[model samples]
Structure formats: structure tokens, C-alpha cells
Target: MRKLLSILMILLSIQAFAQDDKSKDRIDYSGEYNGTFTDIKDAEGTMQLFLYQPDKGRTSGIILLTRIVNGKSEVTTGTINIEGNGEFISGNFMPSEIKYIAPREDEDGIMQNTYDSYSCRWEIFGQITDKKGNTIIGKAVPANCVESNLIEFRINKKK
Candidate 1:
């Protein structure tokens, strides 16, 4: 009877330890977020973010942009940083430096779409309120070359 009690006690303790370790594991931030930059003119789009654990003890993700450029699809994808316990999360996605299109008035004073290139990017860093919550990133540059550091976008995890 004493031996049986000792084994049961050890099993219980091990179970408790396992639960404790699971709680300390990183909170899952993988999901799709829809948002719009409130501070930029004519800025409206959807941001799909996919996060995964690249290896032991680290995290990374990709940011997919749609309709942020003149109705053309552009994307920014890369790593982002999340603060302790997922209370705060932060990351930046820079679109590859490549030649894209630009629209402007030609010498004839008529609107036209021309090809040009610039370093376009969008960054997200803010508090998550909770494991499943809303967040506001302070700055987001649209797919175009127009740089606006004062731009801010409110993101909500889709239900």
C-alpha cells in the first residue's frame, strides 16, 4: 500500500509540472487580421498574417497585402517581434525593392499609370489586449511610394 501511494504521488506531481510548463509556452498569434490605415487618404485593404514557429524558442510570420496599391496586389512579408507573454506584439514587413507602377498626369495633363519603383513597407507594433483581442499599429505605408510615418491602422482578428 505504501509503494502504491508513493507512485500515485509522483504521477500527480508530474502532471502538475506538465501543466505549468504548457502555460509558459508562447501564446499563439497565428491568424488573419483585417485593418485599414485611418491616417492615410484612400487607404483601405486587407492584411493576412500567417505566423509559425521557425524553430525551437523563436517565432516568425508572413504578411500578405491585398488591394493596398492602385487595385493591384502587393505584399510585404517577413519576421515580427512579440513582447513577453503576448501582451504586446511588434513587427515590420518590407516589400521587396522592385520596380512597380505609378500613376500621374502626363505632359498632356491626363492621368496615366506609369512604371516606377520605391521602397514600400508596412510595420505593426502594439498591445494585443489579450490572447484574442484587437490591436492598433501606429504606422503603415501603403504599397505606393508615398511615405507616411504618422499613419496608423487598427487591426482586429477576424472572428
Candidate 2:
């Protein structure tokens, strides 16, 4: 019985050490990341983010989400906030504007209509993934719950 108890105690200590090590393996989420997303079948969208350290334990940045709708590209800007204690790899994408760009003409005789482009208010939560921490995956839900389909995105950092 004593020998079994000793083995169990050793295993518990190892498990605690592993938890500490895993917490220490936090990724530094800085620099720029770009990737694509899909909300539905064949729906293509792009995402770009630039993260920087504003202060100690505070990371902020600007992200752009460009989605194609009816053959025209629409842009939505969001403010990124990674406000946590030591874990700065997970955060959110808060919509800055429903539509960063209004539908207009391109100087020539072409009408680029992106009406209601600013109507996308998705609550997106992103988390860093991969062993090397070079990738980020996120899921979003429309603010008004209009989009029942899953809105998933994945971004990667450049080497």
C-alpha cells in the first residue's frame, strides 16, 4: 500500500509540473496576420490584423475584414483587444464600423455598389493554435443572429 501511494504522489507532482509548463508556453501574439474565412459554401472572405503592444499586458490593433458580396468587395474594420493578465493570445474583434467604405464610383464610369456594407456586426473570438503558435482560428456569430451558418476564419503569421 505504501509503494502504491508513493507512485500516486509522484504522478500528481508530474501532472502539476506539466500544467505549469503548459502555462509558460504562451505565445507572443505580435506583428501582422492575414488569412481567409468562409461563412457559407463558396463564400470567401479575407482578414488582416496588425497587433502591437500598447502597454504592459495590453495588446491592441486594427483588423480589416473584406468580404465579397454580389460580386463587390465590402470592407469592415474592427478593433482588436487582447486584454488579459498573462495570456494574451486569445481576444476579440470588435466591429469599428458596419461599413468602412460606402458604395461609390471608381472615378471612371463604373458604379461600385456596396450598399449596407457596414451592416455586419459579428462577435468574433480568436484563439491562437498550433504548436509553434503561427496560426489563429476564430469563430463569429452575427450580432443580430441573422447568419445561421458558421463564420469561421483562420490566420497565419509570416516567417
The residue-by-residue lDDT of candidate 1 on 101-153, one tens digit each, is: 66789899997655422245555566765555445454544444444433456
* RMSD, one per candidate, in order: 7.3, 9.2
TM-score of 1: 0.53
Q: Residue 61 deviation, candidate 1, in Å?
A: 1.0
- Against the true structure, candidate 2 reaches a TM-score of 0.59
RMSD of 1: 7.3
Who wins the TM-score comparison?
2
Q: What is the lDDT of candidate 2?
A: 0.69
Clashes of each: 0, 2
Which window of 10 residues has the lowest lDDT sum in candidate 1? 113-122
- Local error of candidate 2 at residue 83 (angstroms): 4.4
Give the runs in model 2 whose Cα sits over 4 Å from its true position.
1-25, 54-56, 83-90, 99-121, 144-149
Model 1 lDDT, residue 73, Cα: 63
lDDT scores of the candidates, listed in order: 0.56, 0.69
Clashing pairs in model 2, backbone N/Cα/C closer than 3 A: 98-118, 99-118
